[model samples]
Each structure stands twice: as structure tokens, then as C-alpha cells.
Target chain A: MSLILAAESLAEIINSYAECDASSVAIAAVIHVALIGAFFGLPAGIFIWAERKVSARIQDRLGPTRVGGRFGWLQAVADGAKLVQKEDLCPKDADKPLFRIAPYVVVIASFAAFMFLPFTDGWSAVSLDVGMFLLFAMLSLEVIGVILAGYASGSKWALFGGMREAAQMVSYEIPMSICALIPIVMAGTLNLNEVIHYQSADWIGVIPPFLHWNVFHPVAGPAFIVYFVCATASCKRAPFDLAEAESELVAGFLTEYSGMRWSFFFLAEYASMFLVSAVAAILFLGGWDDGFGIVRALKGNSTNVLDPGVIAGNLLGAGVLMLKASKLVLIQIWVRWTLPRLRIDQVMTTCLKYLLPMSCALFLAAVVYPMALVLGTGRPQILPLSNDVSAEAEMSTSSEVEVERAAADGEVT
Target chain B: MTIDQYLFALFALLTCGGAISVVICQNVVRMAFSLIISLASISALFFLLSADFVGATQLMVYVGGTIVLLIFGVMLTSSSALLQIRTSPAEGFLAAGIGVLFLSVFSFTVWSVDWDRNEAKLAGVTAVDVPPQDYNEASSGNTVRPLAMSFVGLRPDKAGKAPGYLLPFEIVSVHLLVVLIGAAYLARTKRRVSAES
Candidate 1:
């Protein structure tokens, strides 16, 4: 579709020609990781300027009115240069190796979150069925990096900040996941595209189902609300932003960081903030689809701009997903400015006391709601893609088949 | 040998080598780092074997969650101590000998496996395209659903084959709940109990 594909194929060819799978896979992984790195680095550059401008405006000030252009757009770029020029500091008493490595841990954990995230249908690097769970898993890991960063800094302030974060993040993760699960269960599948498609062509009252499309399905309606709240918390947006609440802990766990190392944590924070919003979009808001059904309608048409051949439908799907994810990311940034930060104990109380039970109830309700759909409708409401998988259960359990088949084959080793 | 086989060997060697290094390394921090490598390589091995879900779980839970906890604990406990806690040379040698013997026996059993026709079919997709996702949670095809369902007291996947781990799942959950509570209580600040000193 673009010059990128040509360049990518060329690189893949070069990568595949490497002497072994170890080297080949390693090369490919490096390229993939480099692209992600570029994504993080470039975005941080632009978003930093945007954040400064946005935050300044909220506080009624002229943000960055000096350097780059009419609006101080070059301020972030200038800041990057300054950070690069600054000396890297690790206290004499700081754990040497851990201090050196903590930033990379944060970066890696955030990057790994991309693994199970689907850009489009069947277009993921690894199309995992448990993409939902894996996203949570990787994201939960960000706490570890934060804690380690705090601890390895060897300052009393750093230790306090890190320990507090370790407790807060781990506690919040439970309620956050449980809340997020509400929408997922409503969708019946954890595959990002499937969840979005459920919203893509929703029918409504007035215009014979064509004009009155709604993304909000009854089952997923409340769940989306829940999902947004959970996503905000998961991203550590305002009201839940205790990890580095500036006034309280003197930037909390980020107190000791400066220069490029400090920037890594900020980059990770924003990237993860973007990532959570994107997940919310995919799960609850009907990813990539404009809810007009136009994209879905034009998907298979050959001459349509939406269908440019060679997995164009999938590409469009990816476009829709990314578009939605981007929009949601902007919303997260907006929310960050509008709300005041919550106190630490209050944050934990809101999660453990209030959100936790509500999420559990929603999960239970969603699970049985599907069963009711089956019974009331005289068929499963959700279209069964393949009945063979279900019928196979009647034939024999899968393990029996596996054991019998494995026993039959001579080259299983 | 196929690239797959070589990849398997490479990852296996990494896992074993890293694990051994973990045991041998006297520096506690380095030992934790080596454990991370070993566990990570084992996850890679799981991926190679087409256990993608399990591999991811390994990364998420073991490497990400547990390793972080262990490292944090290590750092906290080693606050005033040197970077490492050294064992006596005699103790180390005895442990190494026991470990070597156990590894040899394990390897011998593994090498002796009869990879029959059925067995080959069961786990033969070394580099195949992802299998069509059929919704047979009762079957091993869908690892995520069955695993989750198994935690909630069902063994649809292994219903006919082996004992359902329903009891174990409940026990683990309760155990986790208790541990969390206990940890919180233990870590909470309290007034000094003694004025005698």
C-alpha cells in the first residue's frame, strides 16, 4: 500500500537469509523491536510538547511560546537535546546493576505489551487467543520496574516511593482487571477484532437498521462504562495517579531520575497510558469502526479505496483499530489534565471497596446473560462460527483424541 | 537438523545453563538475574513447542510477576548485607553433585521417549500456521478457556483423562487470599511491644 511494504519485504529477505533460525529470528526480532522503539521515541517527542502546551493552557499560561515556531512546538525537541547532554547519575550507595537496568525493564515490559495487541484482524505478530490476559500480564509488570527503579536509587525518598508504588499498583491491578473483564465476557471472545465487529454493524430503531446503527449493545453497555473507569485507573490517570504524584512524594518513585533515564520512565508512562486507552477502545468502544457500517460494507469491494488488495480488508480493519486507539489515547491525555490526583489511601479504598464488587457482579451477570440468550432465543444469540468444535466434544473430549492420536504417530518425539 | 530442532536445543541449553549459573553464582542479585534468564528461556522453549498460551503465561506470571517479587524481596532483605551470601565450599560441591546426578537421570528418561504416530500428531506443528481456533474448551485446543474454567472447578479439557485439579485450584485461591492478608498484616507498622530494653 505504501513504500513501507517494499522496504519491509526487502528487509525480511535479508533477515531470512541469515545463517540460522537463531540469527534469523534474532534479526527479525531486532527489526521489530527497533520499529517499536522508534514508535516510542518519536511519540514521546511530540506528546511531550503537547502535554506542556495542554497543561499550561489548563493553568492559564502561554506554554512554550519561545523556541520552535509560533507555539513553541520545538520545545520538546530542545528538551530532548538537553536531557541527552545532561550527566547520568547513580548514587554511590545505589545498587549498581539494578540501577543501570531498571529503565530497560520498564521499556521491555511496555514493549512486550505490544505482542498480543492486534493492529487488525489476523494481522498481529502473534495472534493469541489470550491476548487480553497477556496484555494484563505485561502491564502488571510495569509495577516491578517502578519498584526496582525506586529501590535501586538508594535514597530514602526513592525507597518510600517505590514501596508505596509496589503496594498500590499490585492492589489496583486486581480491581482494574476484574472491571475490564466485564466487557470481555460480554463480547464472548477476547480477540480484539471480534469484540469490535460486534459493535461495527449494530442495528437501531429509525432508518431500517442502516441509518440508526449504535455501537452500544445492551450487554456491553454498562460494561463499557465500567471499562472506561478501569482503563483510566489502569493507565494511572488523574484521580488514580499516585505513583508519581508530584506534590506528595516529590515525584514519588521518579524522584531520583534525570536526563535520558528519567525520560525513559515518562516515555513508558505515556506509552502505557496510550496502550490502556487503546485496549479500552478495542474492548468496549468498538475499535476502528466509525459505527456507520460504511467501512464494513466497503471491506470486500475490490475497487474501493478501503480495499486496495493484498489483505486490504485486514489493513482497513487495522486502520479502524488504530484510529479508535489513537482517539482514545487523546481522551486519556485530556482526562489527565481535567481531574485532580487522588490521595494514596483513597485510591486503594475506591478500588478495593467500591469498584471490586461492582465488577464481580457485572462479570457474573454477563456470564449468565449469554445462557439466558441461548434459552430465550431458542439458539445462541451470538453466531456460532463453527459447530464442529462444539460437536467434537460430543464425539470425544479433545485430550482423548490427543492421547490416541499421539499414541498412533511414531515421530512424536 | 531442522531449524526448529536447533532452536529447541539452543533454548534448552540456555534454560539449563542459566539455571545452573543461578545455583553457582554467589552474588544474590546475579543469581536472581540468572533465574530470570533461565525462566525466560524456558518460556521461549514453551513457545517453540507450540504452547503459546502457556509460554505467555510463563512470561506474564513467572518472569514478570514472581521474578519481580523475588528481586524486590532480595533487595529488601540484602539491605545491610554484601551483594552476596556465600555458602561453604563443601556444601556447594555436595549440592552440585546431587544436581548433576538428577539431571542425568531426567535426560535419560526424556531421550528414551517413544514418539509414536499419535504422539507426533498431538504435538507436531513446530512451524505450522496457527491452528484454526475451534471453540472446544473441553479439548486442549483452547488452552485459555479451559485453564480459566479449570480454576473455577471444571476440567472439561482433561475430563476423561486424569483427575480434575478443582480441589487444588480452590486451595490455591484460598491460599493466595490468606497469604495476601497475612502479608499485609505482617508488613503493617506497629508500636514497639517492649519498654524493658
Candidate 2:
């Protein structure tokens, strides 16, 4: 825990000192990007192992059960070794620059998106007021790189994969953005912290507080469901993953890539899947609030709403949010193994015809629901900062001492 | 001669110089790239002026949005064989000479401007006058709300300046809608007729 908090404090101090100049600011950006890269890189390795096990379970067979352990936890590392050792090949007809550059482009875009992301209130490396918009915009930049990767690859299979990605990510972005806006409108702010807190607000209902959580609001309820579906598509999983319908296109846009380069895409995929889920978790689910109302009931001697412990609180919040996000990502992996990919046209039609309209309707209902509350109660009945998980982020730059102490502990280790 | 003033001068020079080069560039992709450099320098200038929100928006829209889209169009239309559209050398030299003359005149204007930073201190903008609150010290305080309010019909913050851009904002929104539709229609892939037949 101290190790994690140390990184948090280091990031803050590093951010404060270096953010004034292009050179040092860029250095700070690199640190943030490095952490993002590590998060995605490590998780992608684990997901590969998870996918094999999940796929095997779906097929009613043991997957690498004899390797590493009963669950074959080391299976991905072993496969990675095999992939790295295997021949790296590019066809004679392939476009060398695009083929070599594709994976890095994808990885870079996703990493850039992290700079604007708020882990806790004030935990962001770069917090623009339009942080959410900027985050989405950066995420959208990934599609262009993917499209270029496809077009420049000079192969029919690669071209098809790229086109499918261009079509899928671009189309799905609409519904996803609309669904994202549902919470945005409902919260009345595009500031991610404000939106997350607005979603965290505890309702006026009596009885079970857990029941009065996000699951109970008619508008938030539907928006939650809509955002989930759109998120699944945005992450390009299972039914929406027509871009990589492997049986048909032979690994989609990734057909030419191999070794470490190939793995970056998967890492990006899983991390982004987790990222979108975390966004949903922040915007709809009570972020780190534990919707069960347990953690809040436990805080001692602090209406300060923010404190020295708040960074830990947010780290804990992010951890809880991460758990929920990983659960969703796991469900995606589960679905991928169980369900077959949709046809390319069907994927497009589903996005434009169905998901888009449903999200728009939910957005309208959520918007009117809040307005209606104000009319009925003479004052808005919306829950206050209870949902704003980052509101709990205590900006106590006091965590530096703990870092030195943690360094001592690590040296002892 | 503060660092802000120095940085502002560097970025302003970069923006104007890059933008002029963009106008002269024959290759669409190169032009797009030049425009991006110009937009970026302008955004840097905005940041130096303390317009943080505006600077970020400029980056998000101009550098990342407009320039990317422009490059995408160029990429789509341009085959590898024709990396550039060549203008006559005579034309190029003439344009260069004219551009240099224009640049000199622009530079002269740039050297003479006495852009004031409100030394007299305008009253009624209480938010700016108030001594740094603890939270304000922590941030530059989230600029999203102030920018948004300025876009709508409100003057709670900059009461002295013209009220929110109720009309211009709406017009821009409508203009954006039209541009979006026109771009999609124009850029849509059309079925090519067989020219040989």
C-alpha cells in the first residue's frame, strides 16, 4: 500500500516541479505514460492467460492445466516466450513503415489518453476542465493510427481488417459518446470529477441504501445498462469485435505483426477495455464509494471531505473501481469465448440502428428525470457529493514522508 | 522581460511563420502538417496568456481534430506516386518573394504592438481580484465552468465583457452541423464508373 502511495506522491511532486516547461513537462508526461504502459503491458499478459483458460472452460477442456499450476498462471509467459522465439516475418508485398509502426501507434494513442484521466480527485497528471472530452478525443485518435496501419500494410487481409476497424470504432464511437453524454447531462458537468461525484450522490430513498444506489434510479438504471452495452462494443469485444474475426480475416489488422509488437495491441485492448469499464464505473457505479455504503460509514474524524488519507482513499477507490472494471473485462473475455463474432454489416447496423437510438432515449429520460425532481421538490433532490469518489481525494501533499519510509522498507526487502 | 513574454514571442513567431509556410506548401499532407505546427504554437501562445481552457480546446479541435481530418483526406486521395502536386518553379520563386515581403511587413507590425495586460486593473471581475483561496492556489481552479457560462447567456464571471455568445455560439453550432453534413457527403466513397468502357 505504501509502495502504491509513494508512486502517487512521487507523481504529484514530479508533476508540480516539471509542468512549467516543455522539456520537464514532457519528462513528467513520460513518467505518466510509462505507468500507463506498465499497467496495460502487465494486464495484457495476464489476460492472455485468462483467455486461454476461459476458452478452454467454454470448450469443456483443461487449458495448460499442467503448466505452472492448476490454473496455468504461467501459461501466457510461456506462450509469450514461444511467440518471441518464433520467426518474425513480413510478406514481400507488405508496406514496411506502416507494418513496423502500427502497434506503437496504437500503444502511443492509448497511453496519451491516460495523461488526462483522473485516478482520484486531483490525481491526474493533466486535468483539463474538458478532461472527459479530451480523453475521448485522444481515444478517438487511436482509430486513425489503426486505419493507417491497415491501409499502409499492403495486404488484402490487413486492408480488410483496417477497414473493419475504421468502420467499427468510428460507428460505435457515436453510440458510445451519446451514452457517455447521458451521464454528462445527468451530472451537469463534463468535468470528470464532478460527473463521477454526481453519479456517486446517494438518493433520498429510505430503506436499503444499497438498493437506493445507482440500480434504483429509473434514468440512471437504463443509462447504466446502455453504457455497459456501448462500452462492450467500444472495447471491440465478442459480438462487436468484427475487426478481428480471426477465422475469417486471420488475426485482422494484426496479421503482419509478431513478437513484442503484436502483444502491444492486446495490451492496449485489455487496458482500454478496463479503462472504459472504469469510466462507466466512475460515471454510473459509485466509483470507490462501495455503493454498499460501508467505506463512507467507516471514515473517522473527517467532514473535511478531503484529507491526507484521501489519496489512499482514492487509491483504494481506484482499486475497487479497477476490480469492478476487471470483472466487466473478464465478462468480455467470457463472452468472446462463448459467443461467435457478428458479421461486419451486422455490427454496423447494430450500432447505428439499435444501440445509438436506445442510448439517445436513455439520455433524454435521464435529463428530464433530474429536471422533474427540481419541479416536484421545489429544490433539486439529486444526491450531493456522495457519488463523487474523488471528492474523497484528500490533497494532503503530506504523503512524501511515507515515501522515504517505504523506500527503507523496500531496501530491507 | 518575463519568461511568459519570451515564450509568447517565440510561439507567436512560430505560429505566424508556420502558417505562412502552410499557405505556400503545394503538397496537401505537408500543408496539413504545417497547419498543425501553427495551431500548436498558437495553442502554446494561448497557454502563455493564461487562457488554459481555450488553449486545450485549440489542441483538441485544431491540432488533433481539424488537422487529423485534413491529413486523413489527403491520405485517402493521394496515391504514393504523387506525394506532391508540383507548381512551376517560376511561380514558386514569385510566391516566395511575395511571401517574404509580406512576412517583413508582418514582422514590422509585430515589433510595434504594445499589447497591454490591464495594468490599471479593471474592476468588477471579483473572482480575479479575490486573494488566492486555498483551493484556487491548488489549481488554476477548473476553467470548464467559466468557459461554458461565457458560451451561454450569462455574465456571472466576466460581467464587463460582452455577455455570453448566445447568438455566435448558436451560429457556430449550426455552422458546425452544416460542415459536418457537407464533409460526410463530400467525403463519402462513391462508386467509380469504368472510364475505359
Candidate 3:
């Protein structure tokens, strides 16, 4: 929905300056698509470099020290150039067409998932009402491509890897989704922007605004931990990366892939890692809400996109959001380097026996917490932080009115 | 043509093409892949209609969940001999005949319906109860609230005049739970028997 608004506004701006025969919406869309492409691609490259450096530091060894100077910041670029020049090959036994198409499917699914993710206020490409749900749906599509890649590779290791991935991803999704719902239950909306708005206000106008985030909520704090764990497993990162257990499977589903094809899988992996981390940041950490509340002061309830203050605030929010998400991503990388990979059975057990029940309990607590508070006190919130008392009262009264009206209508019928 | 029209044309063509390919493909895996394409495109059509929640649900439940399970089942159960089963000509003909008959009946029923009149009737039922927040707006397209309200027996679209599907929804939920439990129990018993043997 935001796509249409952005495009229409861009079109209006273009028309005021000059006349063009081309469709303005199409032009705007192309530009947005290009921006999104860069957003999706550049992060994967940087994350790859970070992963290497972080792992090297942990191992007490220098990693990629000379690729693009001392820190080897351009190592990912060098690797990409090399991969581009290398030959793309398909095994003779493989299903040729499916094998070729699988990497693209993975890339596209990961990229599409970004459309629903709001980096800052009013900045998502597609602002669907079911933003979180649609994002999950898009992310889930990635597994299909992995499964196809495994099967189409026509190797036993590849098939095993695919089967493991299918089982792991599908099982973990149940817990991950439930964990996500903990915040949704608290926020009372599925729109990511609305969820962030619910966390935008400071606690008691004295405490830091960041403390008001869902992560600080008693129930949601534990749920965030579980969500991050499941997010790691979903991204096929260790200690749950049984799908690509190097010693056992020779890169598993990627055994047959090389060159640009192989890099596509890496790109998808890093992008999804970043995507889930960003989602966690939005869902738990105060997304784009710098602890200082300076951005909110700048925004000041203005809905106008053209406002210079709003733009500055949004840009700052975007920076904060990216920083938080990047930190989470770093933690994921740290966990990958530090922990040993779990066996397939252990991974399944961790999800099914532990994480699933834990997340379910968190979800129940989140739901009951507010209701319990409402019953105990006059207000729904235990903390007399914000103006939630009046808001909760207004909501209850409106619902009560709705119930009365429904009862009257029933009698008439 | 407008962008919407062009998009509709694209997805519609892909849907039909995928369905046709599913039938024509000799390999079971390839057929499953085509089925995924068809189902995903159908979800895209739902999105185009501004049914955002339904579209996402369709993509998640069918394309993401069901198709993955179907592919997994195919890969696990099939041996090399069973991978490419050839249908008998007689069976093929019988199946094609049944499919054609079903298609004809569906088309005939669709063509016979006065869609405009039906739409007017639906609008009449819903018009008076249109909430302050317009859910059908292209920009917001928020149907989740209304959908949830209706599921819980409050028919927001009908101003609480019509009965909601709360009872049936509960029944279906219970039915699914039963099926899940039964499947687990059955699988457990088989594993125990195999262990004993």
C-alpha cells in the first residue's frame, strides 16, 4: 500500500517539473526496486565480511587482512568478482532446469520478504495490514527452494540435507510463529508499524523510551529469547544448522553448487539472517526508537512525508534500527562460531520439546497478563507509565457499547 | 493497459500455464513444483483483490506448508521403480472424462448465475453496517479485525444482524486437533510394533 503512495507522490513531483510520456508509477517502481535490490544485496556482502572477521577474531587469527587493505573490508566484493568469473556447472545426474532455477527461487523469496519489513516509520515498500504474517509467508517460501535444490542436485548428501532442512524449518516455524504472536498479542495488531508505535512512548516520561519496548515486558522478554533462538534455527545457522553440517554432508544441498550459483545461497542466507534479526528488533527491541526519544520529538505527530523534521527523524530512526538489527545479527554470528552444531535429532528435540512449550507459555502469559491487570486494578497496565489507563478505559467502554448494541439487535431479530 | 490489468493478465496466464504443466509433466516432482506455482499465483490473485489476510494465509498454509509436506512425502515414500509410474490409457481416459464433466458443470453454473444481482444483494446486506474504518480501501486493506470479529460471532459487516460462524469454526478446530492426535497415535503404535518385531 505504501508502494502506491510513494509512487503517486513521486509521479506528482516529476510531473510538476517536466512532462514525460512514460508512466510515472512504473518509473517510480523501477527506482524503488533498484533501491530495494541494493538494500538486499549490499547487506549480505557486508555481513559475509563481518562473519569472516568476527570468526577470525574468536579463533585468535587474522582473517582476510589484505584483500582490500588492512581490514579486508572489500573481501566480499573480491569473492563476488571471482565467483562471477568462475564457470557455472550442473552435475550430469541433476534435473537441469530445476537445479538452475532453485538458487533464484531462494534469492527472490528472501528479497520479497524485505518488502513488508519497515526499517523506520512509514518506510516499508509494501505496508500490508498483515505485514508480519505476509513476511513470515515470504520467508517460509525460502525452504521450498532449499528442498528443490537438494532434490534436484541428485546426490545422497544433498537429499539428506534437504530432508533435514524441511523437517527443521517446518517444525521450528510453529514455535517461531507462536513466539512472534506474544508481541502481537500485547500490541493488539499485526501491522509492524503499529506494533512499533505501541512501543514508541516513554515509560512514565522519565525512563528511557527503549525500556518501554516489548523486550522489557516480563512475558515478552523471555519470548524474545525464544524467538531469537528459533530465528537462528530457521536461518539454518548453528547450533541448529544440521542441514549443512560440513563434516557429514560436504556442504549438504550446496555440494553440487559453485561459482555464482553457490554465492546466491550465501546471499539468501545472510539476507534472511538480517531479515529475521530486523524483525526481532522491530518486534522486541524498540525499532528505530532511539532510547533518547529525540526522533519522536522531531516527528511530533506529523503525518506529512514532506516535512524536513520528519525526514530527519525517520533517517535517524532507520540508523538506530539498522544498528540494533546488526547487533542481533552479530550475536547470531557469534553463536554460530562459538557453539557446536547439533545433531538432527537434537535440533528437532530442542524445538519440539523445549522451545515450542516455552513459547506457548510465554504467549499464554502475554495474553493473561493484561487481563489479570485489568481485573486486579481499574487500569489494564500494571505500570502507571503512559496514558494507557484512559486508552484502556476507552477501549473497554467501546467494546461494552458494541456488546449492548449486538444484544439489542439480537432481540430485534 | 493499466498496471493492475497487466499484472492480472500475467498472474492469470502463469496460473493456467502452471496447471497445464502439472498435468503434462511426466515426473512427480516436476508436477508438484508446477502445483506450487499454480497455488502461489492463486494467492497473488487474492492479494490483487485486496484480501491481504486471506492471501497471506493461502500462501502460508497451502504453498508453504502443504506443498512442502507433499514433496517430502513423495521423496521419502517413492523408490526408483515407483518414481515415474505410467498411467494406463484407459485410466487416463476415465480421469480426463471425469475432469471434463466437472469443469463443464462448474462453468455452466458460473455462467447461469446473475453475478450482478448477487453482488447487489451482498452490498445491501453490508451497506448499512459499513464501519467508520473502510477496510476495503486499497491503501490500508485491513480485513483482519473484521474477520476476527466475525469468527467470534460478531458480524461487523452485517451490524450484528446475521449469525456468525463461531460454532462451525470451533467444530473445525476441534476436528483438526482430533485428526492430529489420531495421526500421532497411529504413527507411534506402528513404530512400537516395528521395534518389537
Candidate 4:
């Protein structure tokens, strides 16, 4: 079910039956919050397992052969159990309160970001109009926890790790936000669901629906590549993992953390990795829409929430989104193992000297592309798609009308 | 109370508590941390008020960008000796006196305002003159487009009679550029002097 509608319906059912507004709303909120919490944790567990297995295969070794069958699918669960059992340790010199609180800050920031992400059409926990902006804001809050963890540890390694994270995250956010804006410029809306709807129609009728994605656009294609690079760095994965460079900083900000306190950091990291990948999928790739449009066909003008076909379509759409996101995550894992980590200076140089300028140029190109198309083809869009071009034209004409009306009023006065 | 009022009360308490913590905390890092909490809860208040764009911008700019840089500076420049700077009791008393004075002035101004009359005036103005669609968008928390348009000198909500904020926006951008260049220059000069020495 679309979570928003489901929540409303659940509340309505309770209100009709019991006739208490506050209790009905409260009950619905609790149930949905629990549902979203499970959804948040499940992906992190699965991805952690995938990370270990993928890294193991790349290095030519058997990983976790003894747990949950030969494939060791339950290895992540075992690891969690082990981590939970370990003693939580705090350094004597550490700022104890801040140290204890830091990991929760990181975990909460990433989990809250998930609330803004839609798994399928209208499936978000909170369907704000400015979902993407709010999501980015929430994601940026994770750095504070890392910085606190580093500072509060009172260890030199942790301090250095925290400093590196502070500098790196601050620097990389520039190019990352600019790259994200490229798609927003194209779609002319900050709403992720609207951006998905803009990409729903097939290009040129005979072309596949997948090609309708923004990544195929001449400008957004390069922006996507830069965005992925910046995203990897932003997540502090390998090649840009200077903040937690184990060889140099002895686990960086994580040097003083142990047990579940430490596991919270990892959970936040893996969850954010998945979040950014899902965002890239939604923005550059088609979000939950299958490439074949089979899901759309299944949904087929059904507004009824309990319709079996709509339910199936939503499930299928969510599965497709997850598959796309996981594939991206696998690529991230592949890059982590296959590539050597960059030096701190090199990482900064890559973002500042290369990605920053490149993303800016891409933003400019994205702005000009439609204007150039309109000039050349006498239409705002060149592709034989749906109502997007009309929508654009209508927006332009509406503004033009306002301007004309203003001008006429001035003359009359 | 409704959920919105409950949330407002909660966040308002958090905001005040964080501000108090900032004033009381001896450790500089702890002070900064409390300041973050205060600013973040203020953003929560913005969200509760249905100013979604403003709330997000507050989070992004102040809590994420500005305070992180402030803490970064604190960590980089402070030696162990300077980590915790204790204020004298006299200084504390002076600060508290000034704070009380400021609070009284603020409360006086707030109390003097006829808020209901102003709100009614605003409603009367917009209701009669502005189209319902424009008014709806302004009130609906979907202010991104209207805000962007107004920044570019098109007040869709005002029927285009009033000039938008384009001039002031450009001035702020240029002011920010100047500050950036000044900072870069100062850092560069300091580095050159250190290298020469």
C-alpha cells in the first residue's frame, strides 16, 4: 500500500469504529513508524552481508561459510549478535556524555533521511513537497556525529579522523549538491515523485521506457557520473575514505568506539550508502518504474487502495527500485575493493579542481539544453514524449501573461 | 492538544533548553554542540509552522554548514590550555544583566504589537487583491517556486505590482563573494609569511 494513503485509511477506520480522533491518529503513527523502522534496518543488514560477500569474492576467499548455510546469508545477523554481545568501552580521557551520544546522532540522521525517500509511488513516510532538499539536509547532519566521535575520543587518531571528515564532507558537499541540482533543473521541480513522473513516458514511442531516464540526457549523463563519484566520497568509502583510513589513522573517528556503539556508525554508513544510491536511481534512473512499463500497466488507472493489481504493481515497483539500488551498491563495493584509496590532498583536489568545475559546467549545460532545443525545433522538448512539453509551455505562458497584465496596468495608470 | 501543538511545545522547550545549555557549558565544544541543538530545534519550529523550505535551508546552512565550520575552527586552533575557558562570576553577572535587559526590550516590542489586527489586515489585503491560487500556494508550504520567482523579480503572489527581491538578492550574492575573496587573501598572506619565516 502507499504508506500515506494507508495511514489515512487506517486512521479513518479507527475513527469510524471507535470515534476518537487523537487515539486513531496516534495508533496510525505508531504502526507506520514501526513499519518504516523495520524497512530502514533490513536494507542495512542485507547490504552489510552483500558487502562482506562481494569483498570476499573479489579477494578470492570464502566468506562466512559456517553460518546460515553454505552461502552464509545470515552472516550479517551473526555479526550483529556478536557485536551486541561485546562490552561497550569508553576511554578514561574521553568526554563520556558526548562520546555516548555521537553514534545515536549519526544513526538517527541517516534513518530520518529514509523518511523522505519514496520506495514506490506515494509510499514515503512523509510526503513533503521539498523532499529532496530535506533529504540532503538530513544526510548532511551525519558529519556532526562523526566529528563529535572524533573530538570526544580525546585520542590523537580520533581527533585527526574527525578533522579529516569535517574538511572532506564540507568540501565535497558543494559539487554533490550542484550535481544533484542538474536533474532538478531539467525536471523543474524539487519533488522526487514529480521527477519520476517526468521520466515515466517512453522516448520516441518505439524506444524503451528506461531510455526516458535523465541519465540518457547529454548533460545529465556526465552529471550522473560526477554525482556518483562525489556520492562515494561523501559516504567516506574507499578512494575518499581518508577520514577513517585504517592504515594511517587507526580506524579514524572509530578508533575509540567498540561494540554496538561502533556498530551504530557502520549501520549509519551502510544505510546512507544505500540512501544515496537510491536517490541516484530515482533521479538519473527511473525510480520505481520498471523499464518495461509492466508495473504501470498493472497499476492501470486503479485508484482503489485494496485492489490486488495495484498492490502487486506497488510491490513489483518497490522490488525494481531495490534491485536498481542494490546493483548500484554492488558497484560501490566493487569500486571500494578494486581501487586504491586516494591521499587526503588528492581527494580534496579531485573534488575541488575536477568535479566542482565539471558539475558547474554540467549545470550550465543543463540550463541551456532545453532553451537550445526550443530555439531549434520550435518546441521546448525534442523527444516525442507526453505532456511535459505542454506543461513547460503552459508555465512559460502563464508567466508571460502575468508580465503582460502588469505592463498593461502600468500603461493604464 | 492536537499533535501540532504538542510538537510545537516539545520543540520550543528543546530550543530554550539548548540555548540555556550553551550559556552554561564550560567546554567550548559542548557550547557549540548546544548551539547546534538550539538552531536545529528552531528549524523544527519552522517545520511545525509549515515553512518547509525555510526549515530545510536553516538545517542545511546553519546546522550543517556554519556550525560544522565553527566547530572545525575550534578544534583546529585550540590548544589543551585553551580547551576550557572559565568565565569569571563578575563577567557572568554582567552578561546575565545584559541578557535580561535585551529580553525585556524584546518582550516589550512583542507585547506592543497588535498581532491579530495585523493578521486580519494581511488577510484582508490578500483576500481581496490576490488570486486564490497564489494565496493557496503561499499558505500550502509549497513555497519553493513562488520564492524562486520572487527572488528573480517576479512576484506571482502580488499580481506583479510590487517589485521582487532581485536587487537585494544580487547585492547579498556580491557581498558574499567579497567576503570569500577577503578570506582567501588573508589565508594566502598568512601562508606566505609562514613560508618565508
lDDT leader = 3
Q: Is candidate 2 or candidate 4 better by TM-score?
A: 4
| iRMSD per prediction, in order | 10.6, 17.7, 4.2, 6.0
Q: Write one digit per residue (lDDT tens) for candidate 1, span A92-162.
A: 98877878788888888887787656666444444456668767877877877777787778787787777
lDDT (Cα) of model 1: 0.66
RMSD over all Cα atoms, model 1: 7.1
lDDT of 3 by residue, A23-125 (tens): 7667877777787888798889999999999999999998889998789999999999999999999999899999999999999999999888888997877
Clashes of 4: 0
Sliding window of 10 residues with minimal summed lDDT for model 1 chain A: A1-10
**Native contacts conserved, per model:** 0.20, 0.11, 0.34, 0.29
Which pairs clash in model 3? none
Candidate 2 per-residue lDDT over residues B46-157, each given as its tens digit: 6555555676678666765666667656656777678677889898899889988998999999777654544334434432331211222213444555556557654334
Minimum summed lDDT over a 10-residue window in model 2 chain A is located at A1-10
Clashes of 1: 13
Better of 2 and 3 by DockQ: 3
Candidate 2 lDDT, A1-413, residue by residue in tens: 11012134444566586664444434554676677666666767777788888889889998878768678898878877877786767767665655676677677767766665556645665555566776776677677567656765667787778778876877777778777787676556676765655444343344334443454667777777777777788777887887788889987787777777777777777777767877777677755666654445444336444565554566666677667767877888887777777888888888889988898887787777767887987544444434434333421212432343354345445
Better candidate number, 2 or 4, judged by lDDT:
4
Which runs of model 4 end up more than 4 angstroms from their true locations?
A: A1-14, A202-204, A386-413, B118-140, B189-197
How far in Å is the alpha carbon of A261 misplaced in model 4?
0.6
